[model samples]
Target chain A: MNGSAYGKAEGMKATLIHGTHDIRVSSDVPDPVIRDDTDAIVRVLRSCICGSDLWPYNSADDNPQGDRIGHEFLGVIEEVGSGVRNRTAGQLVAPFVWADNTCDFCAQGLQTSCRHGGGWGSDGTDGGQGEAVRVPFADGTLVPMPGEPDDALLASMLTLSDVFSTGHHAAVSARVRRGDTVAVVGDGAVGLCAVLAAKRLGAERIILLGRHTDRTDLGREFGATDVVAERGDEAVEKVRELTGGDGVDAALECVGYVEAIRTAIEVTKDGRLVGRVGVSQYSDIPLGVGEFMRNVGVHGGVAPARAYIEELLPDVLEGRIQPGRVFDRTIGLDEVPDGYRAMNDREALKVLIKP
Target chain B: MNGSAYGKAEGMKATLIHGTHDIRVSSDVPDPVIRDDTDAIVRVLRSCICGSDLWPYNSADDNPQGDRIGHEFLGVIEEVGSGVRNRTAGQLVAPFVWADNTCDFCAQGLQTSCRHGGGWGSDGTDGGQGEAVRVPFADGTLVPMPGEPDDALLASMLTLSDVFSTGHHAAVSARVRRGDTVAVVGDGAVGLCAVLAAKRLGAERIILLGRHTDRTDLGREFGATDVVAERGDEAVEKVRELTGGDGVDAALECVGYVEAIRTAIEVTKDGRLVGRVGVSQYSDIPLGVGEFMRNVGVHGGVAPARAYIEELLPDVLEGRIQPGRVFDRTIGLDEVPDGYRAMNDREALKVLIKP
Candidate 1:
């Protein structure tokens, strides 16, 4: 099929943010094109609403004109620019970020901090929740799949673009190892994915801290050995009690809220670590003499999705792990507004966008 | 010889804090005794003042009656209570802290947070800078040396009780590995010791951020490959320049001041860590979006000195490393007041108190 088969004469359909709590799918946005020699245009197959997206959705002020908005997607390459090597047109690919992976930061497994990198929906770059995206640094940013995947595998692959990789980063940052006990703070898609990540890293016991039975039930399927429905100091006490008053060996903070971060820190054993992969909503970390006395430290920040994709891809391909279970609902690009509301209101765990 | 040979009939000379900038050696403090079955009386051989001590000295109000002080010391085991096993009388030993090292915290190498732990000079417990100290958790807290060490070796062993071990904690927490580049902030005794610790960990290049020529000269001798005598933003820029504009793989914050911690954080490479072994003087950590975006993290807190002594002792005993050189002056117990003044005034790098 020709690339234009997915595009309208003058534009393409895409998700745009107009104002607080206002999401819209506009069909007047220009279709993505390979503007740079190192770029590739990908026709998006799947996209999803992220918990982080709700941050701006809840508070950002009005813009008379809308701006493009999503970041996670898996797509098929429709066209490759002249200098794009290694990846070709017609390949199925996932772009972690528009990063030049050859930079020093990327060389150190920190693709998020790449000197020549940027995010989608900025500087006229097309967003993921659209008909197609213009991927920068094509050869360095896009991970091409070996073969076409089925629907289930495709959902799991889409998570490789962000959430699953972020959860894995939390596990890695917390230094979860064999025979360790871990506590994951949050029941969002990221937290559920972290349960699978901890299990993959050989954690002997995994605790899920969430009140929702529906989400907690899925967390159990992902390998959480225990669940605590309490909140605040009560949650701290309950987690400590469960760990025999010693606290878990590691804790993962998947919710960006201040209280969630504090609870994660509290439930971690002395001399251990707390991995905070949540996009922080607070500006300061409460680190005082008490935390210092226990030798507890917080480590994780932005996930280097590009660096982790290759390592996690094999398991997803062989059906050993399915992070896609996070997506409990699916809708077309036109339903992007409802998807955002469903996610923000906690009505849907995660809404998949089949554009 | 009897322990009484080192003590007076009614009391023993001990360093006490009276008011701001006021330190005194009183001959009226009661001699230490085996207060519990887990205790032992150690006849003081050597003790030293720490950087943290100055925090209170700079601001604390008057307490005319005076309170016992000092925390780091090495001595001969004078007497052990019946329950004290593994350690016997007459052995030369170092006490990192009065900790029951068998507790879960100690087992995890977080002796500072041990369930049955307490520092010296509180609740009638004898201070280190005295004729003798009532050592709690004798067998679990004391590390016995193989044989009698000379004056030089004795000073190094004294360092194992705190400063040297604390410095080692900074390097370890920062994940300093072979072939890595490291930056150490501060020019205090602990900072100088950190340079040695980084060298032992096989850091390829070591940068010391300090303005003091005399102290930095010792840092160079202790393995600092480069010295950046700049402060604040200038120091940050200089460190980045030294590391090829990429910053260092690890940065150690040995000074507890806010600016020192911030500098350490700024000079660390993206995705790397800053190990803060400094006794935190600030109440909060400035963790913002920029830090999160770069994936920079801060780890480390109080040093588990007891846990590190065994690993670092062999190197000290074999003469492969000399950490005692940080002590630029030596004094008798009665001169403890002058020792504090000298250190506070920057006239002394460190003062060793021989009782």
Candidate 2:
């Protein structure tokens, strides 16, 4: 294949998805290059498996030729295209989405819906879980680190790519104000991060609905005031009892499942907001006229990570927050298959990768 | 039936729903009296047919013994129970839901979800269309008028009971602000009032979606800058084209039908809000993850009319806004059946009743 001028040699190790539960590292994947004037080639220093990646890993149909996978990553820029002025080679940066942040949606802090935006690993773009990635709209999508970050700070900054920003999206969308009581549904990386986000927003109380002791323990340390292992109606009752039967001032739906959304709805008080950042498993939310009439508003979708990265970078740099703790395991590129399996089996909270 | 000693007489003319397409004024109905110390009896002066009332008028099953029907009304206080301290006899006032506004939900401005709240014409409560009515939690539910209003001003003040306040709720919930562009998805009474409300909230542009010329004209008078006579997809397209292909900042769903809500969703820009005050005919909102991911939030429900009356009363009284212009026809107690038919047939925007 004819390659662009900027990046290093062609062949590189990258993760690929062939079929359900089948992920593999391939050496034949082409290294990313400056394919556009606004692009930059990044030598991926760290990447991680996202909870949503498991959806396709479990259900995507078989294809003998695999497709690139993974979206979250931080890296050192290897090259910059002619039009990119904000970034240069060898600079450390975190990338969120492929977005031209000048669009109206981006201007409104919804870069995920940018007019010239798309996800990684599509339309010949390199996946994050690879040796290198071709990042489009470099000036708009990448946030440069102030100085070289230590390994711990690097890992925490990597979360700004998706999870932490997503959690922040939940809290912001729910309009979590100072002294408000919030309920966060789920205890995954995003949910735990949401607890931290709620705390950061000055929430007086955070109730995390999760079953795992290990996850909830971390959640408590992350600022969850109460943990309810119960789910469904029982969870609703437990939250109500905790809130003196008034329900939380706001709720965050971090689990994509319908049951989790229902729980968030049930635990939210009348006239309050329920922020939903989960990649939905169900098409239609179950909110009905009864809920609407009671003024239980449901908002939020995909996190505009690019928009949030700037506001959160300082806190991450200064060690004001420890978002990296959500990543409990690390692996080489070859171990990505095991990483997928471990996450699927609920054995790992998150799995970080070093290519 | 037993009657208390507050009203002029027991038997009174009141509207009843006999079945679908069957509404009648029945003199056999008993006049209301204060059964509780917090109750007050009101002598009915003005009432109006609501868009929601047509739901029962069109679909309610045939019952030889009819039930109480209408809900929107304003009147003079004929008597006040001992415990009522805020209101007194001979006061002209408007009533929303029968809510004890001191409850948590009411305190939070969601009077419709008040813990001890209920609608009119249920559980031995008198319908507002009757000659005289019982108002529970009188201080919490009724807003006293500044002075006796003229016929024109009285018509406008009557709207403060439901339609005007409901319209205000839609605008408020959508968070319409100064210089914002808004779309009102319906040209009914509530829709027209929403246009007025949006204007009052400093919306620079209001696009009204409706097909009726007479109603849309009133909408224009109420401050709609543009009008689209299309429905469904065409309506969405027309509205988008009007707003330079970037949808409205906020949308108000005034029609209960699912199509109107869908239109509201489609015509709203990404990362914008759609406030819905319509009594939804469908159980599930059509907002999927795609819409959610774009940050299109859907908020609003049954308007907390009781809470809004106080905020809207001054403007209605001082002639800064004329929300009462939504009424296109007037009828007497005996002509209530005809009024219902005219409203159902779309021959009247709204019909004011003098009982």
Candidate 3:
């Protein structure tokens, strides 16, 4: 593994997926190169495993040996191309996903839908799990850190790149108004982040649907006023019962399972909304017409994390929120496999990796 | 069937669904009577066959014998129980759906989602396609005519009962803002109404997706700026091409068919929304996460027509809109069977039945 040397070099180390349940960290991976004039090379300092990464891990694709992956990371700018603006070397920044902020979709705070946007871990883009990343549309994709990065703030700021902002997106899309009754379905990091977001949005009541005591404790600390640990139809009934039979005004679907999706819908009242940000483990979410016909609308899809980084960064920097708590375990670049195992085995709510 | 007699007598002619493809005008039908204190009997002036009626016509329900049907109607009050208020004999009015406005859902302007609400022709509620109809929640269900009804305006006013308001619900639920581009995906009467609604909402551009020249012609009159007469994938591609490869800003799915639903989703750009009010002929709309993960959102369901009656009644009364034109053919109550046949056979856009 090249003596596990952690420094900028001609070659870098990266986490690569060989196939389902097969992950590897290679020290001899190629270093990033700017492929676009607007691209910038970032030396990833901290990264994390995402719930969505499980998709590819579970997918049985033939010959899927190497596919660069990981969408969440905060890093220092090491190089910038001629067309890149608003960035310089040694600056710490967090990028949501790869996007050009000038697009109409980005202008409307939907950067994930940017016309020129693409996800991390693409064929050429540097995946966040790697030591270095080539970020396209550098000016739009990265938000400059408010100040020097600190060990205590790195995890929180890192979340700004994905989970934290994604949870905020769910709340915003659900139109979570002040004093609204909200139900968040899921106990993952995103779900806990949603609880925090709902609290930030001024939801008077927040009901979290999850089971693990450890996760629920964090959820409570994040402002979850109620917790219903039941699964399936019973979970739905418990939520409805908690809401005085009127159902919550808004619901956030953070788990992609059919039952979780169903419970989210069932716990929402007529003329309400269910904002879903979870990339489902299921290919299709079969929402029956009965759900829609009741005047309950489903809003929200994937989170446009890039659009929200700037909006939420101030709160994180000023010590208003501590989203880094989601990173229950921390490891170094050599331990990327361990990070994945911890998350996959449910031994950790989330894992942070640093190089 | 008894002799066809007109007026408030021992019996009145009513359209009854006997079985699939079997419709009858029975004069032996008993006159509507006040079953609840809040109920008021109305002497029907105009009514129409709805597209949804085809659901049962295509189904093989055993009770295929008889059930009073038809929801769209405007008429004059014939009598009211002692407890009834806001309605009196000879007063002209239109009811969206049979909803008790006092219900929590109605109070919130989602009358269609009222807990106690039911569609027309259920058990005791008066079927609009009759000489007289017993309306429950007289105060909430019926909207008083803005002025004395004129023969030239009855058809337009009748539309306020269902199709027009339902179409408006589509535009409203889709959150169509003024000066936005919108696509209406259907050629049915309700689709035409959606065109009018989009126009009323001040959309800068309106595209009608349909293959019918006759319907598209009326669509243009209703403010459609473009009409793409294509079906399936070709239709989606045509819309995307017209929209600069980004797809429409908002799409209204007005056809319940799977192809139409698929086309609507495909023609919507990332981060945009598709509002559907079509009563699905299919049991479920199979939407893949791949569609949603791209950032396209789907909203709208069965429109709450009862909630929009008062808000839209003014525009209709001022002659600013001519939704009545959607009714390409007019028939008497006794000719309801023919009206159904005409609609089913695609010989007319909509059929208006007057008593």
Candidate 4:
């Protein structure tokens, strides 16, 4: 099948932010072309909008580089450069990032730091919310699916490209030991996934901080033992009350706001940990002298999704876990602009785009 | 011997910082008297200066209430109150701050967060830079020395009160494993002791960042495998170059400044950690997107010295470690003002004061 078989023209339809609050789906966007032997052209199967996508969407600055925007995508390999190894044409792959696995950094499972790596939609590389995308360092970046995934597993597997792995990274970074109590601070898909991760990691209890009833319900399904609807200091007081004033043993700060970070730190007991997967928006998250005296440990940054894929593969493949349900809405490539709008308006928890 | 036998009159000599750059050896300070069962009046044997003490010495404001001024001391118990069960007169002990070890926080080994914990120089509690002091929470806070320490071991044992244990906290917090490569920032006594801690924890290699020949030599004696005598960016580049661009497995941020913290982060490999023991002086330590992308984990805060004393006691008792060597100068209690001056002037690595 050619690109036209998937509703593509001589060009690709991709999402681009024109300016503040402006998103457009245009077919004039050029199709990804392979420039390196280690690159692969993937025919995108599914993609989704991320919370971080909102930052640029709300920024006052207009898009200057006409950058290709989406990052979360899993696709079938349509073409592999001659130098590509460990992957072949027609295989399904979702890379952690566009990283070469051969670099010293990548060998230790930090693909995000790959020497030759470049993220989606940078330096002419197309984004994932398109008909097809070009992925660099394909051999090191792309992890092949264990088997041909059915639609039941497709969305969950696609999450391996970012969100699910990121949630898992929070759990791992917090050192979520078996039988420990965990509190997750955020209501988005990642925070909900963290609730699931804490359950999968054998946490004895999971407390989720969220106000939205719909997302909180999802939190319960994802193994949240309780949900604290209050926020900031009230939320912290509620968690402390629930934990019998000792605070939870571990906390996951999935919201980028400094207030969320502070609540996460406050709700954790002394000598406990707070894992932060959300991109920090503050230059300095105030670590209060009182909290510092408690000896709270803060760890986690970007998820090296490449490192976590293999660890989570069996769970997803064996039908023990289904992270796909995070997508409350799905739309075609032509409807991406609407998808972004629905997400921005909170009418949809997460939007999946099929291209 | 009575309290008066040790040259104690109705008043005893004490070091008081009246204001910035104003330290006095006053003989009018009242002698400590036990007022509670958990309280013990200790005739101080030895005390030492700390880097944290320098913070207010250069500040503009004078200390209100004239808080007794010091926190580190090793002393002989001259008297114990009725409620004290684990302590008695004549026992030599070093209490971590003035923490009541029976509190919920202290029971968990974080004396720094003890519910009833208070530092010296308060209402009636005196500073350690004196002939005698009243210590609260005799049972829980005081850790008795193994025996009457010889002069060769006294200063090292005195260090267990603060700096050595702080360095140990840095190493333990970093989770220093066998065969890992470690780097330590700052050449202060704490940094030198961190090199010792890393060695004691079985790190394969230790790197020290310092430009001081004398301190770097001490660092080498304390187990530094290599010394990168550069500052800021040059030091970071040098460590990376030496590590073959892979960066060290772990780093210790022993300097309180942002520049040192930045250097520690920059010299660490992706997914590695930097354990900080310095009293953070910056409101915000900027973590750039590059380091965040690499997944650099910064873990650590104040040293829970009370919690670590027992764990490190065996090493000190068996003569397996010589942490005392960090003290490069010794003086009588009357010379404490000079001791602080020498330390503030960078003329001494660390100062030990005998009462």
Model 4 alpha-carbon drift over 4 Å, by segment? A1-13, A16-22, A26-38, A60-65, A79-85, A88-90, A147-150, A288-291, B1-11, B26-34, B60-65, B79-89, B98-108, B122-124
Model 1 CA RMSD to the hidden true structure, in angstroms:
3.1
Q: Superposing all C-alpha atoms, what RMSD in Å does each candidate have to the true structure?
A: 3.1, 2.4, 4.0, 4.0
User: Model 4, range B1-355, lDDT digits (tens) per residue?
Assistant: 2333333457988888878877777888877776666788888998988888887676737765354577788889988877889888898788658787778778877788777887677656788888888787888778988688898687778888899999998898788889989999999999998999999999989999998999999899889999998898899899999899879999998988888888998898888888888888775555545655677767777888888888888888788999999888999978887888899999998898888
List candidate 2 stretches off by more than 4 Å. A1-3, B1-10, B62-65
Per-candidate chain B TM: 0.97, 0.97, 0.95, 0.95
**Taking the tens digit of each residue's C-alpha lDDT, what string does model 1 give over A1-355?**
2334434468889999999999999988888766778888999999999888898899878987987889999999988877887999999999877898998788878889889888888777888899999888899999998787889999999999999999999999999999999999999999999999999989999999999899999999999999999999999999999999989999999998788988998998988889999999887677667888888888889899999999999999998999999999999999999999999999999999999
| DockQ values of all predictions | 0.74, 0.73, 0.54, 0.47
* Candidate 2: tens digits of C-alpha lDDT, residues A1-355: 1235554565899999999998999987876777788988888999999998998999999989999999999999988888998888989998877898898888988888888888998888878898889899998888887788887898999999999999999999889999999999999999999999999989999999999999999999999999999999999999999999989999999989888888998898888888998888887666677787778888888899998898998899999999999999999999999999999999999999988
Q: Once superposed on the true structure, which residue ranges of model 3 sit more than 4 Å away at CA?
A: A1-9, A60-65, B1-9, B60-65
Chain A TM-score, cand. 1: 0.97
Residue B120 error for model 2, in Å? 0.9
**Candidate 2, after superposition: displacement of residue B300 in Å?**
0.5
- Model 1, residue B346: distance off in Å is 2.0
Q: Count of backbone clashes for each model? A: 0, 0, 0, 4
Model 4's DockQ? 0.47
For every model shown, what is its TM-score relative to the native structure? Answer: 0.93, 0.95, 0.94, 0.89
Query: Per-model TM-score of chain A alone?
Result: 0.97, 0.98, 0.95, 0.95
